[model samples]
Structures are given as C-alpha cells and as structure tokens.
Target chain A: MRVLGIDPGLTRCGVGVVDVEPNRTAKLVDVVVLRSPADLDTPNRLVRIADGLEAIIDEHRPQAVALERVFARSDVSTIMGTAQISGVAMLLAARRRLPVALHTPSEVKAAITGYGRADKAQVGAMVARILGLEAVPKPADAADALALAICHAWRTGGVAGAAVTDASAPAPLARTTTPAQQAWLAAERSAAVSGAARRLKK
Target chain B: MRVLGIDPGLTRCGVGVVDVEPNRTAKLVDVVVLRSPADLDTPNRLVRIADGLEAIIDEHRPQAVALERVFARSDVSTIMGTAQISGVAMLLAARRRLPVALHTPSEVKAAITGYGRADKAQVGAMVARILGLEAVPKPADAADALALAICHAWRTGGVAGAAVTDASAPAPLARTTTPAQQAWLAAERSAAVSGAARRLKK
Candidate 1:
C-alpha cells in the first residue's frame, strides 16, 4: 500500500509519499511542497491548502493518508492556525474516503530514529540509511512527512519491525480507547493547560 | 560554527549536525541516532538520553543546539515525559554552554519550508534541494531536527534568507503582518492561549 503523509501549514504545506512493500518495507517516492502568501484570508488560504493536497493526491495516488496529530501551543493564533490547517487536511482525506491515522510528532521521530529527540538531519540520515539511499532527504518538512507515513506503515505492520531500532520500546502513548476515555484524559489535560495558562497570566 | 539539532525521546533520540559557515550557509555534516532499551525506568531512561546527547555533542562539537519546543499534550504522562526529555536536552547543551534556541514545530517547519503547514516530505525535499543534496534525508525526525537548526540560521539571516522559500502563494494562515512581526507577536500568544482556555472551559 502507498501512504501519503502530510505536514499541513496554512502558508507552506508539505506532502510526502512512501510505498510500502509486501514485506513491510517503505521507500520514499516523492515529496512536494508549496508556500502560500502570508496575506491571504483564512478561507482563501484553506482553499490554497486544499488545492495543494488535491494535487499531491492526484499525483501520488496514495491509498492511505497519515497526519501528524495536533499538539497545543502557548500561542493561540499559532494553535488556531495549525488547527485550521489540520482541519483542511482531514477534510481532504475524508473526502477521498482514505483511511487516516494520526501520529504525534514525537512518535514519528521515535519510530524513525529510535530516538524521540532525534533532529532533522538525523531523521534524514536514518531514512536514507534505512532505504540504502545515497543521501538524506532535504527540506526537513518533506522528510518529516515521509517519516510520518513510514511510522504509520510500521504501526500497521505493513513494514518490517526489525529494522526499527526501538521495536521493543514501551508504547510512547496509550492505545486507542473509547471517546469517553479520550474525553476524560483530555479533561485532565485541559485542567493542566488551564492551570498553566492562569499562572502565566499572572 | 556547527549546530547540532536534537529531538529527544526516551527510547530514541535523533541527532543532526550542519556546518553553518560564517556566510550563514548550512551544509549538512552528519546525522546520528541512538536507541535505548524500551523498558528502562524514568530516571534510567533520562540517563540514556543524556548519554546520547553528550556523545553526539562530543563527536560533532557543535557550537550551539536547537530543539523543538515542547507543547502541552492532553496526556499528562506524555507531557511530563516530553518535558523530561527537553530538560535532558537543555542540560547537555548547558554543560557545553552552547546557546540553545527552542522553536515550535511550526516555526521550524516555516523556516525550512515557505509555508508553516508544509509536511515532512516537503521539508525533507527542501532540505535536500537547498543543501544541494541528491536524496531525501532519512529517519525523518533527524531531518526535522536539523531543519530547526537550518531555520535558525535562516531567521538569524545566516543564510541571507536562502533557507526559506518566497512562494508568495496564498497561504491557509491569515497573518496581518510579516513573519518577522508574527514572530515578535508570539510573546503575546501565551496570553491568548490562556484566554482561549478560559473560554473553552465555559
């Protein structure tokens, strides 16, 4: 199966394609990026992003779409902007009826490098080395998008796990629970965030 | 001066190095990744991360360090773990007195790709193309961490703005000011987040 990973941005969104082999191996196929103007209105920007996503999907024909999950930032505008971008991505994938999976940025790093803290160059090198390529991926976001796809492939057992160094690492996160569970968990997070925000306000 | 970018995880931490010439051009030098045992406890896991960071710094001797800033996660456990890893990165950089800059994932992505919404593969491709490399960087996290360093170089005008694209296409984000101004406005983001949290609670 071919998987497409997206790093959605309002101005500059990244797209990467990885083909997963029957033996559970993934190889990089292509990466495309476009930068939108900063001055566009929000709806216009989303349209631009949707256009980019459509172009990528048309070109790559990926069977599945994997996205990096949203993490809360201290900046409201940044967080809102990211959510809007993410929403666009989800809408695009859902429109195509493609199965979508979300991975945290840390999960992607950990899955690719066996180190959650690995940097971009390290991830590029690992991707290159894993595929026995001549060099690492460029334009870091492209590489990250690829990594997200790869991580999904690995998670789904579509790729060989032995090559991933942290195959035995404890699950970095809990398994998928019910919406109720998720809500409860999120409530705790909301409380923590609120507490921190209140403290920062002072 | 060479700057090493690190993405820290309990089991795997990605590392990447780029030589930032006096002229502000960043050339990829090396990327390394280390994997720790999956079952190690919190303290031991931190030690593993610390050791890996030290080793990378010693081998690369980077003049500075750049990392993706931690954001709040709904999972308290995950957030705490991320903070711990961040602390480990900070400690290693501090030991060497290397100036460390923390960037949000979007900032790093924006710096590397023209759009903050750019995906991982696009970022990787950009990294490769900008650095004049032939292939996408591997293990994606390494590439992203490295991108953070590259973004810093670009933002500091080290590359004379060569690192970022000027696509000027309509972006999904609605920014009223230039990115430089947007960056300066981040200080107020904390307050905005706090207010949003309050509104969400009601």
Candidate 2:
C-alpha cells in the first residue's frame, strides 16, 4: 500500500510517499518540502500550500495519508499556523477519498528510533537506515514525514495485513485468520526480527 | 459592499452576510449556522464545514470575508478545531479572490458595542439594533457573525470608501482622497456619532 505522509506547516510543509510491503519493508517513492513566502498573507499562503498538497496527492495517488498531528506548544503563534495547514491537508485527503491517520511527534519518533524522547538527528538517521538511503532527508521535516508514513504502515500491520502487533501482549484471537493471513504475519515477524538483528549489528 | 462574516468551528460554524452603504447603514442579507455531527471523524467534519462554507460563498458572492481570528485558549482541545476551521474559511475566500480579514473577539465586540469587553448579550443586542432586526440572532455565534460583518464594513469604510478612521487621532493624510471619498468619510463619521448617541439613549 502506498502511504503519503505530511508534516504540515505554513512556511514549510514536508510531504513523503512510500510503498510498504506485506513483509514490512518500505520503499521511498518521493519527498518534497512545499514552501510559501513569509510576507504573503495567511489566506494566500494557505492557498499555495493547499495547491502543492493537491498536486502531490494527484501525482502519487497514495491510498492513505499519514499526517503529523499538531499540538499546542509554548510557541502560541506558530501552533496556529501548523494547525491551519494540517486542516488543509486533511481536507485535501477527504476530497480524494483517502483515509487519513494522525500520528503525534512522539509516536513517530518512538516508532522510528525505539525511543519517544529521541532527538531529531536520531530519528532522521533511523529513517535513512530504514529506507536504505545513503543520507538522511534534509530539513528535518522531510525525514519526519517519511517516519510518519513508515510508522503508520507498520502500526496498521504492513500493507494489507491485519491486527496490530504489540510487543508486550499476545495477539488477540477474537477474529479468525486465514492461512494466507497467518503466513503473511509469520513473514512479517521474521522480517522484524532480522531487521532488529541487522540494526544491532550496525 | 457585501461582506460575509464567519464564526468558524468544527461543530457549529456561524455565517452571516450583510450589505453596507456609504452612510454606514448595514442591511442583513442572510444568516445561518452550519453544523456537523460530533460523532463524525475530524476529516469528514472538516469536509462538511468546508462544503457548507463554499456553498454560502458561491450563493452570496460577497466582496469581502470577515473571519473571527482564533486564539490559543485555556481550552487547548477546542482551539485546534477553531484554528482548523478558520483556515478553511480563509482558503475558501482566497479561492474566490475575495479579501479576507481576521477580527478578534474583542475587536468584534468593541466594534458592535462601544466596550471592548462587553458580554455576548450586549453585543447581540447591539447587532440586532444596528440591523433593525426584531430580536438578536439566536445562538450567540450568529449575532457574532453579523457583528463581524458590520465591523469589517465600518472599519474599512462603508461600501469601499476610504482610509480607516481613528477615534483617538486624525485621519492619516499619506494618501490623497477624492471629493467623493471625503464626502463618504464625513457621512460615516456622522453616522457613527448618531449611532453612539442612540445607544447611549437606550
């Protein structure tokens, strides 16, 4: 499944697209940082960002969108703009009939770096390593967007697989699983184990 | 000049339209509150509000939009939704090539009532009186929306007239005003004075 991730803002909005496989591997499709001038009024700035997002969604045609949920920060001024752009992003996704999932910053960091308190550099490094890129995506927001996409894909059970895997708890068995689904889950578990081993080795 | 005023929210968005003349008289064009169900997801709720706002703008064809500016409040949860809807309103206005102006709650209140910190009932009473309505618009948001429209119209000078008038200082002479513009400004000043006198009598 192709997932589009967005780190929304007024001045700079980062967008990344990735395809996740049933075995829990992710490949980068595209990444971009859309920007609007600071001197422009809020309305025009919103329009520019909205247009950029629309173009990206049309070009990639991602099945789902993963957005960075905005929180009210100490910086009251910037938070409003962040929330505004996020709204625009969500509206665009709804217009195209794509499902949207919002992931908090800490959630994205923990998913990518195994620590919710990890710094930007650690998350960026992990994102680069996961996508097998030679260098981390620039501007921090770009790497964050990619991490959001990977996190959503993994949390939702790889491409089309079912049931979230909790490290501390056994899988719930209320619903029956087909043989094909079981096999896919097994493959996913193995892949996760091997991926952790490789990271430990590095 | 026709102005559409919006009190944006995810659950209930208030919209009001009015036409203001050169003499600062405002006539109600239309007023309504758009609502989305609380059970709906954030994305769909946003879509519903956007559609409602778009339809109103298309139908009214207002020359300017006056949206209530959202502020960070003690209630953090509601602020995000307010900011989001405000963004949508601004975007809609921009798409139609109409100028959008954001007025704070105090600004709207002060514009309608003489006191900046006037309570809701006071502002509502003033809005009804200004528009010559029989009663205050129901659901405070509706009256607030009309207040926003009247405020914008008055602040910008009635029906596309001249520079902003200051109660504390003389009008800036930076730009030359035509004879017709001067006449409009004089009429606006007299209307403001008479309006204040009427309110004082009440």
Candidate 3:
C-alpha cells in the first residue's frame, strides 16, 4: 500500500509518499516541501498548502494519508498556524475519501528509530536506512515526513486499519459504541456546549 | 454588504449572516449552529463542519466572511480544534474569493456592547438590538457568531476596507503587518524555518 505523510505547518509543510509491502519494508516514492511565505495572508497561505496537497494526491494517489498531530506550542503564538494547517490537511484527505492518521512527534521517532526520545539526527539516519536511501533526505522536515509515513505504515500495517483512521470513512470512531450510544453522546455534547455557553453569559 | 460570521469550534461551530446598509444599520440575514458529536472521530467531524460552512456560504451568498480570531486557550486542549475549525472556515472563504476578517472576542464585545470586556450576555443582547430582533438569537454560540460579524462590519466600516482585508485575507496571519513589510518578514521566516530545521538534525 502507498501512504502520503504530511508534517503540517503554516510557513513550511513537509510531505512525503511511501510504498509499503506486507513484509513491512517501505520505499520512499516521493518527497516535497510546501512553503508559503510569511508575508502571504493567512487564507492564501492555507489555500496554497491545500492546493499543494491536491497536486501531490493527484500525482501519487496514496492509499492513506498521515500527519504529525498538533502539539501545544511553547507560547500561545504558534498554535493557530499549526492547527489551521493541520485542519486543512485533514479536510483534503476527507475530500478525497482517503483515510488519515495522526502521529505524535515521539511516535514518529519511535517508529523510525526505535526510541521515542531519539534526536533528529538519529531519526533521520534511521529513516534513510529503512528507505534504503544513500543519504538522509535533504531538509530535516522532509525526512520527518518520511518518518511519519513509515511510522503509520509500521503501526497500522497499511490498508487494513485505514477505515478506522478516517472517521469520515464509514468506520466507527470508538468501535465499541452502538448507534444509540453515539446518539446519546451527541446529545450530551449538545447539552454541554449549551451549558458552557450559558454559564459564560453569567 | 453581507457578512457571514463564524464562531469556530469542533463541537459546535456558530455561523450567522447579516446585511449592513450604507448607513451602517445591520439586519440579520440568517443564523445557524453546526454541531459535531464528541463521539465522532476528528476528521469526520471536521468534514461535517466544512460541509456545513459550504452550505451556509452558498445559501446566504455573503459578501464577506468573519470569525473570532484564534485565542490562546487557558486549558490548552481546545486550541487545536478551534484553530482547525478556524482554518477550514477561512479556506472555504478563500475558495469562494470572499473577503475574510477575524475579530478578537474583546473587539466583538466592544463593538456590540460598547465595552471591550463585556460578558457574553451583554454582547448577545446588544446583537439583538443592533439587528432589530425581538430577542437575542437562540443558542449563545449563534449569537456570538452574529457578534463577530457585527464587529467586522463596525470596525472596518463594511465594504470600504474589504480589499485591504481580503489581500490580508489570502495572505496574512499576524494581522498587524503591511504587505511590503510582510513580504520582507516572510523572507525572514523562510530563512528561519530552514535554519531551525537544519539545526534540529545536527
């Protein structure tokens, strides 16, 4: 199966596609970086990234899409840009009906280098070796994308768990809940939101 | 001019459209809340939101889109969901070539209630009065969306600064920089990202 992995960001988004076999071996199919200059307005920058992903999807046609999960920023400043990019990436995958997975930074490191705490160089070298590349991918972000794809492939074994990954793809979210249970949960959320909004008014 | 204002959240996204006359009198056009269950998987919930926003835009045919600017969450957990929803809303506006604005909560409060730190009830009540409604919109989130639209209309004086906002719309994030300076700043960002990525791997 083929997987497209995205390390999403506002100024720079790293994307890589990989082909994985049942034996768990993975090969890098393609790698590219999507960058929107900081001077660009937010909407246009997001559009550029979304458009870039569309081109990649059309070109590689990966069976699944994976992304680096959004993490908290050290400051309040960087959160929106990261989340916006992450949101756009998920939307793109859903639009194409492709399954999506989100891996934490440590998840990528652990999958690629066998250590969740591995530094960037260690992860890069491991990703290079696993993909049978002569050198680590240029631009560490791109290598990180490759690491994410490899991680998703190794963790899910590709193809089989894709439906679970894409909550929009007719798979159960929690797997254990019945439709009735889900309906109850929905009602609970509605009540909670209304309650929260009401309380805030006081 | 008509404005579609979005109060973005993963659990409940509030959207409202309003018409602003030349004299700055505003009339309500439409209001609705798009809700996703907590039990729903993330991607599917996002798709539900993106689809809902698309329908709202097509139906209302608003000339501009506005939303509450992403703010730092006290709890941290809510930031990604809010930012992602915000991103999708902006992407929808960009796709349709509509101008978009982001109003801070305090700005909305100030616009509607004559006080920057006014509570939600005060803003909602003022929104009803401004739009000439008998009562505030049902479901506080929807009221909040209207407040956002009203804020944008009042602050930018409707269609006059739209071209500026939209240019800032397609491109800007920080919302404070001029275009030329933003471009130079973007170059600096490019250098910084490359530098940061390189250093991480070393």
Candidate 4:
C-alpha cells in the first residue's frame, strides 16, 4: 500500500510518501518540505502551498493520505496556519477521491517509537530504522511526515487485502496469522520484554 | 464594483454579492447560506462548501472577494473551522485572479454601523438599510457577509476606478471630493456628531 503523509503548515509543509508491504517493511518513495515565503499575502501563500501539494499528489498518486490532526496550541497564529493548510490538504485528497486519515502527534510517536511520549529524536531514529534509511530525514517536519506514513501503514496492517493488491488476493486472516505477521508480532513482543527489562534494571 | 463577501464557517458559510456605485449606494445581487452537514466528514464537508462557493463565483462573476478575517476565540474548534474555510475562500479567489480583502469583525461593524462594537442586530439592520432591502438578510451569517461586501466597497472608495468600470473612467480625486463622496463623508460626520450628542445626554 502507498500512503502519503503530510505535516501541514503555511510556511513549511512536510510531505512523505512510502510503500509498505504486508510483511511490515516500508520503502521510502519520496520526501520533501514545501515552503512559502512569509512576505506574500495569505491568499497567494495558500496558492503556493496548494500548488506544491497538487504537484506531489499528481506525481506520486498515493492511495491514501495521512495528515496530522491539528490541535489548539499556545501560539494561536501558528495553529491557525496549521489548520488552514491541513484543510487544504484534505480538500485536495477529497478532490482526487482519496481517503484521508488524521492521526494525532502522539499517535504517530507511539506507532513509530513504541512510546506515546517519545521525543522527536526517538521517533526519527525508529523511522530511519524502519525504512532502512542512511540518515534521519532532514528537518523535523520531514522525519515527522515519514513517521506518520509508517504509522498509518502499520496501523492498517500494511498492504494485506489493500486495493492496490491483486483483486483475487485472499482476505486478511482472522484467527491464523501469516508467517510474516507472526514474525512481526513476535518482534514486538520481544521489544516489549526488553523494554520491561531495562525499566527493571533502572 | 461587484464584491463577493464570505462569512466562512464549516457548517454554514454565508455568501453575499453586491454591486456598489461610487455614490456609496449598494444593490444586493445575491445572498445565500451554504450548508454542509455536521455528520459528514470534514474533507467531504469542505468539498461541498468549495463546490458551493465555486458555483456562486461562476454565476455572479464578482470582481473582488471580501472575506471575514478569522481570530482566536474561546471556542478553539469553531475558530479552526472558520480559519480553514477562510483559507478555502482565499484560495478560490486567488485562482480566479480576484483580489481578496480581509476585514476584521470590529472593522466590519465600524464600517457598517459607524461603531466598532455594534451588536449583530445593529449590523444586520445597517446592512439591510444600505442594500435597500425590506427585511434584514436571514441568518446572522448572511447579514454579516453583506456587511463585509458593503464595507469593502465603501472602504475602497466604491466603483469610481474599479476594474469593472470603463477603463477611461477618471481616477478617484484626492483633494477635490465628488458630490457623492462629499455626501457620504457628511453622513459619517453627522452620525459621529449624533453619537456624541446621545452620549452627552446620557
């Protein structure tokens, strides 16, 4: 399954695309930060951002979009910009008949780092490890976008029975898990056990 | 000059179009409230609002757009929705090459009612009177949208040198006031004097 993740902002919007396999591995397709100058009027700035987003969508053609859910913050102006760009992203997705899924910051962090309160560096490290990247994507927004994409893919059980797959593909197993799924579950369990051991040692 | 005013909201967006003359008189062209169901997802609801706005613009062919500026308030969610829709409005206007002017709530009130703190009823009454309508536009949003359009027209000195007018039209005078401009200024001064007199009496 191909997922496009967006961390929306007026001045800097982060976009990342990833292809995920049913085996819970992800491959980086593209990642970039879209920026608009501050001196420009709000309307024109939005047009710039919208154009960048449209270009990315047209080039990548992802099956789904994962957007960061905006929340009220201390900086009112910043939050307003975030919300505005997020709305634009969702509108673009809807126009293309693509499904949009909103994920909270903490949800992405937890999905990537196995801890809801994980710091940015931790999430970035996990994302690099998951995608087999040489370095964490530059700029926090880029890494965050990648994390969102990985989170969505993992949460949706990767590409099993996804639309992009063959129509004759069997439905996702209910009681029985595929070998890859079992391995993934076992890896998670091992990680949890090691985390508990570290806490005990502390 | 034809102006399209938008009082943007996610659930019910108010839109009004008016034709304004250099004499400070305005005739209502169209006014309607575009609604999207709350039950619908945000993306779909936004798409619906965008479609409605596009249809109105196509039909009216307004020369400019006047949108209410969003501000932070106690209701964070409401403010977010307002900002989002406002962004959409601006983007639409930009795409059509129509200049967008944003007016704060107090500015709209002051322009329409000669008082910055006028209540909704007072503003609505002024809008209806200015448009020569028998009744105030239904729903506060509709009235507010018209007020925005009228305010923009009045602030920009109406249609004297507007693009919709003939290119050979004379430029707006600086020192020498036109008869209509003088009358409009006199009316504003009279309103100010009366307001002060009333305050003194109180």
Candidate 5:
C-alpha cells in the first residue's frame, strides 16, 4: 500500500510518500517541504496549511494516512501551532474517509535511527543509509517527515505481510478495556490508594 | 519484509511487528508491551529496557527498526530521561546491525490520520478498524506503536514494488543533512538579510 506521511507544522509542513513490498525493501516516491511564515494570523495560516495538505493528498491519493501522534504539553505556542497543522491534515483525511494511524516521535526515531533519541541529523542520515542512498536528505524537517514515512512503510509492511512470528501468545486486546473505561478504573485506583494511605497515617 | 515499530518510554515501551505483502495488506505477527518501572534506578531501567528490546528483536528478527523521533527542549531532566530511553533502543538495534529509521510524531499522525491534529483516541480507534479489529485498541501508546508499523509497511511497499510515479523526485537519501550544515546556512541567510536591510535603509 502507498503510505503518505506528513510532518505537520503551521510554518513548515513536510510530506512524504513511500511504497513498500513483501521483501521489506522500500522506495521513496515523493518528499517535499511546505512552509508558511509564522507571522501569519492564525486563521489564514491554518487555511494555507489546509490547502497545502489537500494538494499533497490530491497528488498522492494514498490508501492510508500515516501521521505522527502528538505529544501534549510541548508549550502552548508549540502545541497550538501543531494542533492547527494537525487539524488541517485530519480534515482532509476525514473528507476522503481514509483510514489514519498515529505514531509517536520516539517510535519514529527509534525505527529509523536505531536510537530513539537520535537528533534530526542522525535520523536524516540513517534514513538515507537505510534506503541505500549516498547523501543525507536536506531541510531537516523534510528529512524527518520522510523518515516518518519510511518507518510506517517498514512496520506496516512487516505486519501486513505476516512475516512477524506470533510466539503463540494471546492477543492483548482480548482482556483490555477501552480508554474511557480505563480512565474510570484509574480514578478508582487512585482514590483507593489515597484512602489506604490516609488510614495507615492516622 | 518484516517491520518492527517501537514506541519507547521510561515506564512502558510498546512494540509491534507487522508483515506487508505486494498487494498492500498487513498481518499482525506480534505486539507486546515492555515495562520498566520508575522505582528502578536509571541504570537498571536502561538494562531492563535494553533486555526487553533485545528479547523482542530476537524473537521477531525484523529487517528494519522504525522508531518515532523525539524532540525535547534543553531542560536537563526531560532530556536525560529521553536520552536514556532512546539510548537503549539504539543500542538494541545497533547491536543487531539492523537498519533503523526515525520519524516525527506529526509525520506519523499525518500519515495515519491525514491530519496531524488527531487525538489519541481517534488514532487508536482508526488503527483497530484499519486492521479489521472489533474495537479501538487500548493503552493509547500501544495502538500508536502499531499504527507506526502499519504506516511504514505501506510507504516502503510502494517504493520496493516500483509503484512510485515520480522517478525524477529525490530519493530518500537526498534530504538527510547534518545539523551543522543547517546551522551554517541559517547563519549565512541571516547575515545576508541583515546586509540587505542595511542597504534598503540607506
């Protein structure tokens, strides 16, 4: 399947398209950086971001959207900018009803750099080397975005091809509760812990 | 080819292995969560994380490791924790001499959700549904990890299968660049702009 990976930002959004096959070899289709000035007002910037996202999607028409999962509390400005950028992407994906998946930054870095904490440069270099390229990708943001795409392609291809061994373990989903339910349970657990601590102290 | 996606954290690391085929379908071979409690010292945690990673790799034997890219502020404490977790992942992959790729969170979310701003629950729900599961996956982290694998599978499959349309486009290697180069360019640009501004004022 063709996976379209995007690194969302209000000012410098990056998009990458990658193709994967059964043998685990991956090819880079298209990778580009789309940027806007940070000075632009929120609404206009968002619109521009949306337009940029739509253009990439229209051009690529990928079967699925492989996006990076957001981390909260990165700072208000950063978070807001990221959220705006992310919003544009989701709007387009939902418009097309395309399935979407989100991955964390560490996950993407670990997949590409062999080090979860590898900086952008390491990731860029590793992405180039992994694909058997001679030079590291340019514009760190774009390279990072491409790395995201490559990671998705590799992991998804492995899963889809059934190459991973099951190890005869039961599925985790079998006994797990949904997020909403888990939240409720978590509250109860905390309350109980507090109660026990109070009783002991008294 | 089998792709392994790892979502690294100090406490719980989520790992997923997926196999992709020529026709663009993914089959889950294995998914697991590794836990290293905060009660353990940093070194012990690192050891635990490393051991868990090695064990997973040994069982799965993925051709490539796709990790999420982490970008943290210069804050000492946060950076240290991130570094340790990332270091373990890197050590594991490097020990095996396996190729690795890193991607930012925005990129992964965009790839999967077509919107960089997708919420965790939304991402989890979509991942489950895309894999043809009955409901959303639990422990948001695990689902995100799985999604990362799925994204990699799709992108790389297209590349390896020669499905990409733009042969003229830069290959994956073209974008990777060292941070020093980027810094130098930024400085140069700033100087040039300052000179231009002076000229304009004159």
Candidate 6:
C-alpha cells in the first residue's frame, strides 16, 4: 500500500509518500514541501494549500494518508496555523474518500526510532538509514514528513514490521558492531551516498 | 446589502443572515444551527459544516460573509476544534469568492453594544432591538452569529445603518423615548414577536 504522510503547517506543509510492500520493506516514492507565506491573506493561503494537496493526491494516488492528529495545545501561537493546515488535509482526504489515520508525535517518533522520546536528529538518521538514502532529507519539515510515512508503514505492516521494539531501540546502542560489520558498514555508506545523489537527480 | 455571519464550532455551528437597506435599518433574513454530532468523527463533522455553509450561501446569496476570527486563548481544550471549524468556514467563503471578513469577539461586542466588553445579555438585547426581532436568538452561538452580522453592517455600512454609536452607546442609555415611542414600542413588540415566531417556523 502506498501511504501519504503530511506534516502540516501553513507556511511549510510537507508531504511524503512511501510504498510499503507485503514483505514490509518501504520504498521512498516522493517528498515535497509546500509554502503559503505568512503575508498572504488567510483565505488565499488556505486555498493555495488545498490546491497543493489536490495536486499531490492526484500525482501520488496514495491509498491512505496519515496526519498528525491535532491536539489541544497550550502553545496557542503555532497551533492555530498548524491546525488550519491539518484541517485542510482532513477535509480533502475525506472528500476523496481516502482512509485517514492520525498519529501523535510520540507515536511517530516511536515508529521511526524505536524511542518515543527520540530527538529530531535521531528520527532523521533513522529515516535515512531505513530508506537507504545518502543523507537526511533537507529542511526539518521534509524529514518529519518522511518519518511519518515510515511510521505508518512500520506500525501497520504486521508481523514482518513492528512499531518499535526494544531490540531495534535507540541509535547509540545500534552503533556497537562486530569487526566484519565495521568494514561492511563503511562500504555500504559510500555506495548509499553515491546512489542517493544519482536517485535524487531523478 | 446582505451579509451572512458564522459562529464556528465543531459540534454546533451557528449561522445568521441580515439585509441592510440604504437607510441602515436592518432586517433579519434567516438563522440556522448546523450540527455534526460528537459521536461522529472529525472529518465527517467538518464536511457537514461545509455542506451547511454551502446551503446557506445558495439560499441567501449574501454579498459578504463575516466570521469570528479565531483567537489564541489560554484554554486549549476547545480551541483546536473551534479553529478548525473557523478554517473550514474561511475556505468555503474563499471558494465562493464571497468577500470574507473576520471580526474579533470584542469588536463585534463593541459594534453592537457600544462597549467592547459588553456581556452576553447586553449583546443579545441589542441584537434583537437592532434587527427588529423578538426574543434572543437561542443557543448563544446563534445569537453570537447574528451579532457578528450586525457588527459588520454597522462598522462598514454607510452612515445611516450604524448598530450603536459611541455617543448613544449602552442599551439603557439608548432607551430614550421619541414622540411615538410608547405606542410604537408596544406595537412593535407584539407584531415582531408573532412575526418572528412564524418566520422561525419556516
């Protein structure tokens, strides 16, 4: 199933799509960041965001869309704009009859990094490693969107995939490797970096 | 000019419409309450609100729409839901290209009651008097919506139809009797009350 995950914001709404096969491996389909500047009037900006989502849905045709369910937030400043973007995502998805799943931020972190408390750096590294990409996605919002896609795939992927297991835990512990693994890891890094550059060009 | 005012909410969205002629005296056109039950999910509720707004626009064909500008409140509980509804209202208005105007709560209060901090009772009484209606519009949200409409008309309307002038401010202060005040006031109360009851039935 192909899933589209959106990290919604008024100025920078990020979208990332991933295809998760029966075997539980996920392939990065595409990622983009859309912006509606603060200076623009609210209605105009909202319409732009909705139009952008329409294009993304038409281009990607994801079977499902995952959004960060808006929570009651004490920080009123960012929540309004964020919720507005989130509202657009929800309305459009419903209009298209696409099944919608809402995941909390902690759920996303746990799914991506096996630690609900994982920081942005940890989530970014895991998104890169799991997707076999060269470097982390640029602009934190993009990485976050990709992370959301990966999270959905892992959480719903059945026995072959899991949300977060203690075994796959934090990255610092994953660093300990055998001598044979050390050399293999170095080679894999160089190949993946070059391959990522070539793939990104497309 | 005809104006539609929206008091946005998740479960209950209130709508009111009024027409102001060249002389500035306003007449109530219609009022309605739209619902998306709490038992229902978020997206479905949002669509219901949008559909209700569409119907209102089609039936009334208001020249302009007024919305309660979403505010940042310390209370986080209902703000997200309220803001989402507000966002939906804005988007629909934009889609129809019906000139959207947002008024803050205090601004609406001040326009109608001549005091930005006027309590609900004062606003309700003033709305009924200003629009030539009988009784307060039920469900505070609906009354609030009507108040919003009156605010827009008075604030932007040409000199003749002002809701309440700063000089003649406050319900009690504006209660001065003209030559025909006693008989006219009595007739107006009886006639308007019965007329309102029949209008509401339809």
Fnat scores for every prediction: 0.00, 0.67, 0.72, 0.63, 0.00, 0.43
TM of each candidate vs. truth: 0.42, 0.84, 0.81, 0.84, 0.41, 0.77
Give the alpha carbon lDDT tens digit for every residue of B1-202 in model 2. Answer: 9999999888889999999986678999999999988767678788999999999899999888888877789987688888889888888788788887777787676667756677888888888988999999999889989999998887676544232221112232223355665565556556644676346447
Off by over 4 Å in 3: A162-202, B160-202
Error of 2 at B107 (Å): 1.3
DockQ of 5: 0.01
> Under CAPRI classification, how is model 3 graded?
acceptable
lDDT of each: 0.62, 0.78, 0.76, 0.78, 0.59, 0.71
Error of 2 at A14 (Å): 0.7
lDDT of 3 by residue, B61-171 (tens): 988888887777776556778888999988889888887777778767655665567677776777887799998897899999998887676555565335334322433
lDDT tens per residue, model 4, B164-198 = 21111232222334576657755764674477323
Off by over 4 Å in 5: A1-202, B73-79, B158-202
Which should have the higher DockQ, number 2 or number 4?
2
Best-performing candidate as measured by DockQ: 2
Model 2 error, position A178 (Å): 14
- Least lDDT summed over 10 consecutive residues: which range in candidate 2 chain A? A164-173
Query: How much native contact recovery, as a fraction, does model 2 achieve?
Result: 0.67
Off by over 4 Å in 6: A72-75, A158-202, B158-202
lDDT of 5 by residue, B1-202 (tens): 6777887776777888877675556677787777867654343455566677788789988876766655555553444345345534643564465655555566566555555566686667656755767876667768877877776555454232221111112232224333554454345336534543234334
Instruction: For candidate 4, write residues A1-202 as lDDT tens digits.
Output: 8899999999899999999987777999999999988767777788999999999999999888888878789987788788888888888888898877777788687667767677787777777878999998989999999988887777666642232211112321222345666566557646744663234334
State how far residue B21 of model 1 sits from its true place (Å).
63
Return the clash pairs for model 3, or none: A40-B171, A41-B171, A41-B172, A42-B171, A42-B172, A44-B170
Measured against the true two-chain complex, the DockQ scores of the candidates, in the order shown, are 0.01, 0.38, 0.32, 0.32, 0.01, 0.21
Question: What TM-score does chain B alone reach in each candidate, compared with the true chain B?
Answer: 0.73, 0.82, 0.80, 0.82, 0.74, 0.76
- Cα miss at B22, model 1 (Å)? 62
lDDT of 6 by residue, B1-202 (tens): 7889899888789899998775557899999988887756577677788889899999999877888877777655467778888778878877887666777788787667656676787777778878877798888888899988876665554222222221112331133334354454445445544553234334
The window of 10 residues in a row where model 1 chain B has the poorest summed lDDT is: B160-169
lDDT value, residue A132 of candidate 2: 90
- Candidate whose TM-score is highest: 2
